[model samples]
Target: MNLRVPTAWFLSGNRSDSNYTVGVNNTVVGFQESEDLRIAHDVITNSILVLIILGMGCGITLDQFKLHLRRPTGVAIGLLSQTVVLPFASFALAHSLGLETEAAVGMMVMGVTPCGMMSTVFSYWVDGDVSLSFTISILSTLLAFGTIPLNLLIYSGSWTDKQFVIPYSSILVLVGMTTMPLLLGIFIRWRLPKVASVILKIGSYAGILLVALSLVMLSVLYPFMYWASWKIYIAAISYPYISFMFGYVVSALFKMENFRRRTIALETGMQNFTLCFAILEASFSHVTSDVMSVFPLLYGVNVRTAGFVFVGIYKFMEKYGPKPVLTEEAHHLKHANNHRESFRLEDQQTSKGFLDSEAAEENGES
Candidate 1:
């Protein structure tokens, strides 16, 4: 049964004027900015990117990455699903749903880009395998640089009212900007574990705060994608959820452990929107650019927000739920993290006591 119906039944929208506008006039969407403003937004976004990179650096542990590598089956399966399955599924959905030309291509790009950093938090919140989620997110992001072009070549051939090209030079810029930062963080941690540990502990909240500030300040500077239409939004919101559900449900069918399933679910759901958005921002010289604009603005925001809510709901039920599906690997990992956290607390207490005692002794002598 073809389930396609008036999308309005489930979603909200009007289908007119999906194009760029000008002077608060034509509904067509384009960047309306003085060169100076454009430069400012770029500088500000880059600044935020730097903070995210450093924050991720502080958080990443090479040892955790190693453990992820050790479980080749999980990692391999996840990479395969993320790199191959999700993109194809998204392509199919776009075709069947008759997603707008730009939107379809955008979905393809997003599907292949990556599981995101946010998935790690969602994984933890849901009692999922944080390790597996991180591994998939990193590996998938790396793979997209290669596979996105292939997706364009294969799936995009039919959508050819216009030609789409990804400049290798631009892609190289993106990879360098995104991954190099994370890798640099890894290096810093290795070179100075003590310093890195302190950074990692507070990095998440601090980093997010910085980006939020940057985004607000730059909102006027950067012309936001105008997606006031219903048709455009339908494509934006539905695509991510469809792809995510495909991964989430399919992973469960394999009867994988609950934690693994949950991790797979969230990893498939979230994506590195910042990276995809950057690619779009750089390459937004075509109709595909419109797709790029809409997807990240709509798809990324909705999915991550929904993902976080799901994570929170799961967190509330965590202790109340059935016993965990901690495979031996995850069980050992949980124990290790607990032990490390315990020792950290103990060390802090001991250090404080020693300081207090020394101060008391000095006072007595005085």
Candidate 2:
């Protein structure tokens, strides 16, 4: 009744020869004795990654970019929390928890990846700053090419025994996958708004389908025991909540409004897990890839659970709690409306007074 699962059962072909390695001198090496199924799997996964990026880009617009940039404080804080704080948090957690090499590296990868659309959706649910959420999502993704490699180089090396050269080619492919589709999506949004909407829907649904297929594949290939480790569960469950708290604290310390604070917190907590999965699958051996994949899978589930809990609490409070106070902008708008109404009444009285005086003069003269 041994529950421990071997990687060979999941991945076809011999595990020993399937290791894809880069030399210390940054040489790119091919997979030895690679099977066609593995190659096809890689291609499909990368394609799905591209589509997901495209869908994300489609959700953004130049207007959002300009709006957030005009007031850059919130955006700056968000990027700092995302690229700097989250990675540091993950690195610390992995080391603190004493995760093994694959899990540690997985945690690092999850940290460095950009925020996903789920953050935006969760922001909306929790009455967060949705505009700011969109801005952070797009900007973080655009900057991911540079930030991801830098973060990986800075943190991932320590977790592994081998020299982890920066994966320039894979990153370049990521850049192309991210940038080109993003720009195309933006252009479609600008030129053909209707078409872009369709693309967005298609991309989202297709991406979900592909990810579901991948999970099914993983479940079928890798047994339940592969994911039964206590370390993985602890790291996955705590990671998002820790990230959420850090994001809130950082934004609150900067004196951000509550909505924006919530937005940043969600953005920081929810990492783009699909992208992380794709990177690990491409970069590591089948065994390592399979092992690392567990972190994101578990993380994705737990993060969503945290999001739902937050949303539920928010709804409960909104329903039963005290009436919410007006925000600064709303207060100003209310004051402006009241002032305008007073001016309108004064103008009407003045006109009436002038007409009455003229009528009296005319009557007297008559």
Among these predictions, the greatest lDDT belongs to 2
lDDT of 1 by residue, 215-307 (tens): 454334332533334555666666556655766677777666767777887777776665565555455554335434555556655675577
* Residue 116 in model 1: lDDT: 64
lDDT of 1: 0.58
**Tens-digit lDDT track for model 2 on 205-292?**
6655655655554444334324335777788889888888888888899888777788888888989886787677667765667666
Model 2 stretches with alpha carbons more than 4 Å out: 1-64, 161-226, 328-366
Alpha-carbon TM-score of each model against the true structure = 0.68, 0.63
Candidate 1 Cα deviation (angstroms), residue 208? 4.1
lDDT of each: 0.58, 0.66
TM-score of 1: 0.68
Ten-residue region with minimum lDDT total, candidate 1: 1-10
- Clash pairs (backbone) in predicted model 2: none
Error of 1 at 269 (Å): 2.3
